[model samples]
Target: MTERKLKVYSEDEAKERLAKELPHWYVEHGWIRRRYRTNSWKGTLMVINAVGHLAEAAWHHPDITASYAWVEVRLMTHDHKGITDKDFQLAKKIEEVVQWQPGLEGGALEGTPQDDLRFAYIKYDKPKA
Candidate 1:
């Protein structure tokens, strides 16, 4: 498979694009950034380590900072000197491995809410009881 190149975009343009790629997070300091707050430090580190593994395997890395209950990730193409599609692709993979649902990207990109929230389909975060 051919690697997808991240299309570079301006700061404002990136935000608009990010709405589609990552509705919950936003671009900061010219990188795709997200902050995750968990209940346990151990869980956070584990997730960070897992993400690190994936990044290395993909040959595309995201800068991650973790301590206590928070893990922050920043993705940008240093070679490109800005953001690119690689950042978005890695974000998608992270979402899958981490068991997270991308935030509302302004509007529906697929089927209904029930369809999007199919418990049988998602294995990460469980529905609140």
Candidate 2:
């Protein structure tokens, strides 16, 4: 299949979209970025692996910077030399997969127990009121 041409967004435009569609993400330098706080090195690695899987599936990779307690994902359309739909799409997917909490869904898939630090991973962002 032929690839669709990507439209690059200006800084202002990128920030506007991020505000509306990706509230947790921000534009920095030339990339749209989001930092995920983790509980420990294990959590950080989990976040990285999740992002990597989504990025690879989408065929659009983000630059990842990870430490013991956090992971930062930076996305830009390298070929387009700017932010584009590809970046936003991939970022959204990464956010969705990384922040998912099955326990909150009222289903059988209970998420990690909050009482146990050993079971903890990503420090999920709470919804803003």
Residues 49-103 of candidate 2: C-alpha lDDT, one tens digit per residue: 9998898898888899989999999999998889999999998888889989999
Give per-residue lDDT, candidate 2, residue 27.
97
Candidate lDDT values, in order? 0.72, 0.92
Candidate 1's C-alpha runs over 4 A off are 1-6, 100-129
Residue 116 in candidate 1, Cα distance off native in Å:
26
In candidate 2, which residue ranges exceed 4 Å CA deviation? 1-3
TM-score of each: 0.70, 0.95
Candidate 1: residue pairs that collide: 6-84, 6-85, 7-85
Q: How do the residues 1-129 of candidate 1 rate in per-residue lDDT, one tens digit apiece?
A: 664555687899889978976775698888988776655665687679878998999898888988776788899887787888778888878866665445433454542243443322322345446
